[model samples]
Target: MSNDQPLKGQIIIFTGTPKSEDVFELVEQLGGTPISLPLIQVSEWIEPTDEQRLMTCPTYDWLIFTSQSAVESFGLKMKRFGVSPDAITSQIAAIGTRTAAALTKIGLTVQFIPTVFSADVFVQEFKPTENETRRLLFLRGSIAGVTIREELPFDVDEWTVYSTEKAVHNIESLKNLVQTEKSSTLLFASPSAVNVFSEEIAPFTGWDTYKIGAIGHVTEQALIEKGAHVDVIPSTYTLKDLVLELIK
Candidate 1:
């Protein structure tokens, strides 16, 4: 590795949504050529007539937020509904530490979070007691899976507060880059991103020289299911951690 630019001659493509400019900057600092090929984008989903009911009612025993996007969308909708964050007196559950932090910043106390940051682990460990009623409300993205719903043995109401759409981008530049570069690395952050890439982008050739990386188990599974070979996955499920692992 070159001391000044360990990744100086490398090329990397980021295919996830909600990308951070800082991650690209970091890649440049490490001497890698970073490509912005975001395969999916998220938008808040709003339904006025049905959402209006939330402003006047606090009927849920628990509120679940699985992603930071979910937290942001829920916050915006709550404001539009005239429902304050504090007005919902239900216990809060977050899927990951980042989700918990996002909720905490908005003055909502998080009551539960799994150690593994996966839906399977969360439901297995945080089930309601047999006598207790679990009238949980899940605010999530349209593409987010229903693993919690499938695994949880209780009543849970889910509402899609955001939609994940395929992001449109010109692949010509990426194709040119692939042809010229010796090899490249692609990073995936979620299953939805993997699906978008497989469905919309993978048909193109020239990816044989590209290495693939996923953030964690769920994303890795998507990669496998899509027949994409994963070359790396961080022990921890975080972008920062993934970067560090890649640099290693």
Candidate 2:
């Protein structure tokens, strides 16, 4: 292998979708083959009342976003309802850098971000201005936990803007890949994706047979709980950071 191609002959599989072109390009740049074996799919899931609530989102004191999918779904809702970014008077808080970037891409300014990306860290670190009736709205996915809503000491409302489901259709593709690539590395970005892979794929292709990479602690914990040994976890929770760790 050439000195520039540190990851030559390595096959890195990403178990989430829609696939990120940036991640794929990064892996290829390092002389690694990037594969997208999507185990979870996300889509917008808006209700009739959600439209009304989103239209009046400016009334809230703070808007919390935990994932990029939530931010994308929120942007879609704003476009659909004709809600202009200039009309938003509420301060925005994102869980991590990627979520913050997604919000900023839609012309919304983020006022706060936790030192850590996890919700548990966010709850402990984020402190809104003290008010008698501070209202916080969390734009979340259907499978998200209640940490933000239950832990925050404010009147927090949640809008399930997106839903995630197992991408079972890709199971055969995963099996095929596992059969062919004995030394491939599997990277998981979310606990949901880990759960899906653990349930459907792990039984067929033993968990310990491949090197595993988790984007964050939550996903690492999920893999550990499922009897899978995680090989790499980046200090920073991002795809680029995770890929860098893998090459190192």
Candidate 3:
């Protein structure tokens, strides 16, 4: 019933970028060895001319960051532009807590955040006030399928801040892992991982014996659509809850 209880001798595989270091540390602290295997790689949008313009812009209305990757990508570019990050004086809005933390790490504070961190809610927060229709700059990803522009309450400037690329697993590496079968228990935290993992394990079948743990409803739906017979799903939407369910 408690996550603090020992969970040794049980192996689990983490599927996502290194953004989940906090959760991984918790797993290790709780006697579980966390294996890192990123299903998708978050890449920064590389554009010489476009980035130059974004960096040289004067103070804008709002600077919205949708993902942690966008924050990182924009931060790197800002550093290159000789801006101490303090130069960008737009009221920042982070879509989620993680992205908010990422912004803080680079000396930025989020002015607004919603209860639901979806793109729909994110767009709705961009309505122009009575003062003036402030210009908005949205930092997103290259393959960002989720768009906040369509439902935007106010017309604002926007562009790709970073990009999401499906990571193609190394054949020999995957084969070796499958041959030894080290990752018997796979964890699907997001739907994006489910899509990428399906591709990762496509050529290496015989994974029906492995147990799958879906994190939330969205990931559960992705698992079901991918033909995975999910064996575990925690009621709460957190990694600690999922680890507790496994040990229980």
Specify the highest-lDDT model's number. Answer: 2
Off by over 4 Å in 2: none
List the pairs of residues colliding in candidate 3: 140-161, 141-162, 142-162, 142-163
Which stretches in model 3 have alpha-carbon errors above 4 Å?
A: 1-6, 56-59, 121-133, 169-183, 206-208, 214-217, 229-248
lDDT of each: 0.76, 0.88, 0.70
lDDT of 1 at 224: 88
Candidate 3 structure quality by residue, lDDT tens digits, 1-248: 24464656455676766575777776677676777676778877788676566764445677878778888988888777667766777788887778898999988878887655656666666555745446677777776554665567666666776777766663345435545765457777778878876766645764476777876776788889888888888876455567667766
Mark the regions of model 1 whose C-alpha exceeds 4 Å error after superposition.
128-133, 170-176
Root-mean-square deviation of every model: 2.4, 1.4, 3.5
Ranking by lDDT: 2, 1, 3
Report the C-alpha lDDT of model 2 over 1-248, residue by residue, as the tens digit.
77788888989998976334998998899999999988999999978886788877988889999999998999898999888889888999999898898888998999999988889899998886697237889898999998999998787888899999999899889877976898799999999998988788888888877889998898999999999999999998888899999877
Q: What is the C-alpha lDDT profile of model 1 across 1-248, one tens digit per residue?
A: 69767877788887775434777888889888888777777888888654764653367777888888888887777777667777878888898777888888777889888777778778888866665444778887887777867778888778888888877663455555555665688889888777766776577753466888888898898888888888889886777677767877
Clashing pairs in 2: none
Please report how far candidate 1 places residue 124 from its true position, in Å.
Answer: 1.7
By summed lDDT, the worst window of 10 consecutive residues in model 1 runs over: 48-57
State model 2's lDDT. Answer: 0.88
